[model samples]
Target: MIFMHIFSSLCVRTLTNRAHAIGDELAALFLLANVCLMVMPAAVRADETTGTARIELLHLWRTPGEQAALHVFRDALSDPSMAWFDTPVQGGATGVRKQLSDLLAAEAQPNIIQWIPSEELNQLFDLGVFRTVDTVDEDFADKLLPEIREVAETDGVLRVLPVGIHTYDFMAYNRQLFERLGIELPTSWESYLALGPLLAESGVPLLSVSDENWQLTAMYRTLMISEFSKEEVLSMARGEADLETYRNRFETTFEILFELRRFAAPDREDLRWEETVARVERGEALSILLGDYIVAAFDDPDKLICARSPQSSYIPWGFDSFVFTHVDDPVLLQGQTRFAKAASDIDNIVNYVMHKGGLPVISGVTPDQLDRCNADTLVAWQKRPLLWEGLLQGKNRIMAMNAVIVTIWRDETITPAQAAERVIDAMSRP
Candidate 1:
């Protein structure tokens, strides 16, 4: 009952952890709820709809290209000739979780919700909050990128359709600015750290990042994966590994975090990710550590140079996906199928890549037509591994670790050794 209460309150806007750490207690509670729900199958209704079926899709993305791409799905799902049903796309970032929680509580709810095929979401799937789309169309499965196909499915049931593959932890720099400064991009972590003071001396911010929790989490995760081997990161995520077991790796990771703070833009605490990228675009900053979505902000490929995060063999990536609801209404079920078809359409997938500046998940949607930087990112994507497997699968471990790193970054009093202990302590809590 307490788990249900927490689940019911998750979508409460006032309680959402937008700017701070997602509390360890709340995350643990959800983990318990997820474990209990695993034994029960999600309920599906077979009730026939007596009237027109209308469904709402809730999403957090907001960009001109994303809006346009979403409109394409809107039109396709609304076509009268399709005999299934009409659907509407609703956009919002604030209060989206609250909205989803409320919607899922209804007997007749929206047909689909935006989903990312990650460990956290898979827990929701296990709780029966979403329905499988594996049988919707066999062809859709064939179109998914090989790297993400297996992750999209749970226990042989596919619950989401991936729209695009994204690299959340990569470095993007200003080519023109770097050329003028006569400094080559660093290829190793040590070399990269060495640039901090040099860039500071030149009055150029070496990197731009946001103060936002999720962004901080992404940065922390990037460093963790880079400093530790994949096996170590995965083992830590599984609770089998601890800071004491790999103190050197953990301390080194936090030391890198603090060193970068030395050259970070002064206004980083107040700037949103878009504004931070703008610092690089305007040549006020030499480079930025952010998501591939930053590419969408650039007008020309040559203006920006993308690279695998320095000293890292694998890049942390994410993908856009949608989860279906199991409503009994025939019309709504038909609408769900129609929406999936539109999402899987090659033309739509291509349009998404052109507009959103990421690698389309569907096969055959090549990046040949994209600008040089974007095309290069796609090519480089093949060399990196998605961070979804093992401990990186869920948001809790990474977020908890990031919360500690963020504190250490703001307080000079905290040493890397102490930060390492804090992260292990936070994550080890029951």
Candidate 2:
């Protein structure tokens, strides 16, 4: 159960491929937030052909549903005025962020990015690499919830333009499969664990998950956000809550995370998030705890019993965005403005978010406009703050702490107490 071998081999491959760039280890040592999102003349892939404004994009949407929403922009840009080109970046946005250590070491910006709020991305924002949302529309602030607008305008700068609000902290499963298992739908993480024996008889794992760093972080954060009260989570992030104050809850939470191995697919180590959902769709597993963005993978959204986290009376939420990096070219600026204008338009963004199973960032979206899970969860989520991303408080210390959880999961010798101590230590570090 020493899964460090998997991480080690993966690191070796990355090191060999990157050849002389810093790996995750050295990047952690330096503690830079993200590789600077600076683009050299060659890095900025803009070409003007017959007055067509073209933009090269690095994004994370690949599913049919995801593609459907993406096509909204694609179709919008096809009118000879502007267009977007896929700049292939491996591992999507979250992957791009995880690989930033090497991205900086190699003086390259190729992979890993998650649109979550962070101190590192914030640094890049302060440096003015990304354009402001107001440039898209003078009155763009009128379209979003005041709080969402506030997050978009953190520090009074409107740099991040969120297209859709979403949450990956939910667990969704096939209702028929749950009924066939002859057990009631488990309402919370504790209930789910209590039913483990019954679920085992059905010859399927109870959950499906991805094993990579960012995905694992999402999984861990989902549980942490769900188990603790919003106020507690906020306080912990603010360094107001000490370990002794919440030691029992912290240990119990980590224990539940450690126990997840009993219910997860055995070979999910290298599976894409989509592949994990595929297993659930085919009934190879009973359910998957993932973001609502993957709703396209299911054959029927109505048949799925989806809820925010295995626990969480209140939904944990976040968003997906199209962040624009500044380029001085008029055509590229026009293209970026056109893309943002299209992304936040009521009619346009609705279609995009619906295809991806998320709520539109534009105001006036009613439940009737959404799918079952989203419609059912929307009201409660309205009152909650953004999930783990909002809780980031600008520290990448979550990376080091997540390593402790992974160790606890992959090695039984590391007790939850030990993991909790390691987490407390990570939180205390500079």
Candidate 3:
């Protein structure tokens, strides 16, 4: 089973990377594709003797907490007539998308997959990647949260199975560290900066962040969200902002992002989000500003202290979901329907949220100890803005923006004003 995943991803990457090169590379790619992962069929029949279907999965879940939550999901859908196999992809949605494309190009079909549910998700169904309705439980669509129920919905039919939900902007800290230093949560940018000297004297860092684009952007974007109203942020994202608006919006947050450098954990430019979470859990840093999903990463609940970022008044939410490739086999289709029903079951979702760290889509879910911070805050947080980070479907130059953000932290010459200028320049490009 382990050997099945190896050839497909590597073979696809090798062929794709060289396709743009001239002459010899083109010839090599043509020859290589013949012997590569195309030979690994996406769908395989069940063992005749056992009559158990093999449900292979391609997903982006790898962290300790996500893995644990995935196990719980598998258990809920487990059946004697089926078995689960994993083909984990390290490169997140982009990687999974690329590999899935290569497999499909080769006419191989990997049916079950993890996808970020958004408006664009319907594109998959439109492209003949999968279909809904008949594949899901009759009541599955009605069971989802209204916001989730509408995502990836084409016409009156939903195209994807909503799995887990979360907001990435929330901050979680070490309670013991804050108490030891007598530090209070910052209500505004000024207050956050005022704590600098206190944190400096105590020789503890203020927060942890990573250079990974999404991780850095979530932190950067949240700070932006704190500065702007929800309507303004959504408006800017929609490209309604004029030149001065971009300048004002970006510069204000970049200034705070620049100041935040003095408080960030040292030498964390290379850290992954999970590693940063561990830093806070170890009390090595005072806090970590990341998605609330990281709650399960901490072994002890006593060490966790949760808060929204400075002036964060909105609760931005998004759902993680699974979408299937069309399958004609009755047995496979039955398995898909079973999995969909299990995933949307209110009780199953509540239990899954225990390890997954977000609210169930339906109501009446009481906040367990870890979820109290995110769940309890929803009442007072007021505006429930659609989450902004992953929802952007390349609307702006993300790589260009990410490069400027990295330089803003590592190179002081790239001043906040200049970062604002460059960020606008990035945003302006096609």
Candidate 4:
């Protein structure tokens, strides 16, 4: 099996890197494809009789921790007593998408493909191109977080094995500073606003925010989602909700943003995200509202404490998964099942979270040795309802509207009512 995996990888690399090496490269690939067809049938027959199989894994990542998690899985697959050989074909997000596209079109099919859930997830499932989790292992289906498991399903069938749930909307603050100043973390948007005058009097900002369009846009989007439930947000986005119905909420959300602006750092526009967080780290600011990446940024883990924004009811998150692709060979099918099960096991779960810095989706697999902020994040993940990322589309549209709304509202160029109208107008665009 190992020999077969090495040979197959060499064939793929050769085909990829040497496509233009000869004028008849296309003809050569056609011949090679024919050779593969001839060889696979014999190999499948051999594997069935010998009880051995080989599978390929297409792994995706954006961080070093994720890369480390991939290595953990690879090491598990390398167990000496195992009957199958697994090889990892690696790439970043864009490369993973290209690989999945090719595999879905049946141009190539690795045994496992890792990716985030997207709008096209159900379409792919409906085509019968991937295996459901029930087909993999019934016990495995029982191990995932309820919300994470729910989102992985299509028509009540599980289609993906989740790796981690990574939340993006969170606030990190200095616990010591807050304790010293005798202020509690805000429990709602109103409480957040009430902190403004106190923060101003202390010469510390209520929040450390950046003027980076995406940063502000992400903050606004969270506030928008929190101001309304996911269902309401989606309805308003689809133009199903009348402007008059949501106008008050939109106005309130904008008011929160404007009020925070008054207490923000004077040079916030010139500060990078790291610099903005540094203010909170140094106790120069009360808090910073951003993504979970801040959990890993603290030099002294105990110095930071994180919580979901006061307005957030369900934490909006992104996740990674190992999605199984369909294969007819029984040995290869069994190998794929084992791969999925191995990924969901407790040891891998903890290692992935500890190394990868994301919340593990399986229950009872707490990561060890986390600093205060990361521990808080893990607790929040377990306690809060999960809203998977990418549910909110039209980011460029949101960013554009937010830029106009923030600029005009801050400068008193538009009334909150008119700003609400502009928001609805932006949503209505094609």
Q: Which stretches of candidate 2 lie over 4 Å from their true place?
A: 1-47, 97-115, 119-122, 154-157, 383-388, 393-397
> What's the lDDT for residue 400 in model 2?
56
lDDT of 2 at 309: 71
- Against the true structure, whose lDDT is highest? 3
Q: Backbone collision count in every prediction?
A: 4, 9, 0, 1
Which order, best to worst by TM-score? 3, 2, 1, 4
Residue pairs in candidate 2 whose N, alpha carbon or C atoms collide under 3 angstroms: 93-113, 94-113, 95-112, 96-111, 96-112, 96-113, 97-112, 97-113, 168-291
Between prediction 2 and prediction 3, which has the larger TM-score?
A: 3
The whole-model C-alpha lDDT of candidate 4 against the native structure comes to 0.65
> How large is the C-alpha RMSD of every model relative to the true structure?
6.2, 7.9, 5.9, 8.8
Q: How well does model 2 score by local distance difference test?
A: 0.64
- Tens digits of per-residue lDDT, candidate 2, 1-430, equal 2555454445445544553344333333223322222222224333444454655556666666677777887787678665566643467654444444444333333211225554455556655434465556767767786657766776566667777777766778877787876767676788887766667876778778777665676688777765677777667766677757777777887888777876777887767777887788787888787677768666567778876676664555667776775556566666666766766667777777767776777677788887677786676567656554565544445555666665556666777787777788877676
Residue 194 CA displacement from its true place in model 3, Å = 2.0
Task: Report the candidate with higher TM-score, 1 versus 3.
Answer: 3
lDDT tens string, model 1, 246-325? 87778888888888877778867745666777788888888888768777665564688787688776666777777886
